[model samples]
Target: MLMVTLLSIACCCGCPAYFGKPMWEQYPATASLPAQVADLSLRTDARSENTIRELRTDVQNAHLLADDTFAGVYATRQGKTATVFGTTGFHLTPESDAEDELTRLTSKYDLGEQQVVETDVRGEHQRCAVGRSDGVDVVVCTWADHGSLASGVFTRLSLADSATLLGTLRKHIVSRD
Candidate 1:
């Protein structure tokens, strides 16, 4: 009787131990922090009213994705097209160097080819470039004045629409003094 009880206990314990090994093996831990910190960080803000006003009017359903001290992203959708307009204020960095950083950040998207263009923004020479993605187009505009550098990107719109939208957005960007 004693031997039979011991065997039964061992069998019950053995079954769980056997099953646990496969469970652990199937779901191995592989989580690690990113090696490099991204210069751009975005979040969804549903209650914020501090983003670009023109961007909200351009699309049917507009929402603010992020609102940081130096950057912001506004997401919108029209028909089947999804778009994102991002702006970054590089006041802490040198104006001359902000263009390179903004370029690097925008390059993460699938911009096929790039071309420079003139924008309606009030600046002697603002850096405005347009590129085409898979089926969407993107426009990036950068300007420097006084000690501040500002850059904006409008993505996933038609070439004409992107250009038009950027022009409207540029009007609202207050140049640094």
Candidate 2:
């Protein structure tokens, strides 16, 4: 639901970027789940794999940016599993760009009644919500900087735990080059 037309305008007219960052830059991002993240192991089962595949297609079809990269992971620890799907793309409005993705994620999972979480992302804008998924209490967190957007589904975990884990995961999964 976003476009990259302003980059051309800025380049043509020599417009200054926000906080010295150019709108045309792609942020050079990469996402992955390591073998362990705060005790969560990377999931590679058929169901997890299929879910990630379908979700990645959704991200691609969203047409969020002119140039985008998508990544997803399902990790399990102590019998609790979570899925995180994310993309890195350039958008004129980084602050609210991820909100659409968050809404799409919650609706896709049939979530109801979300509570916003106040987690910070390097002083960038982030929105998080907690809800029930498949009768399991869970939290979904979304974060966006000038470069990237992501949301996660944490099953059988409290909001605090999900937020903390998501923060940690974002640190590892998303990075600038």
Instruction: Using TM-score, give the best candidate's number.
Output: 2
Give all candidate RMSDs, comma-separated: 20.8, 7.8
Off-target runs (Cα >4 Å) in candidate 2 are 1-18, 21-26, 64-68, 112-116, 119-123
lDDT of each: 0.41, 0.68
lDDT of 1 by residue, 20-54 (tens): 54333322112111212122223345532344334
Best of the candidates, lDDT: 2
TM-score of 2: 0.75
Tell me the TM-score of each prediction against the true structure.
0.38, 0.75
Reference-based TM-score, model 1 = 0.38
Which residue pairs show collisions in model 2?
none
* Tens digit of per-residue lDDT, candidate 2, span 27-143: 656665676777787777787778778878877787655355554555554678768877776655655666766777777566655555565433355666767777777778777
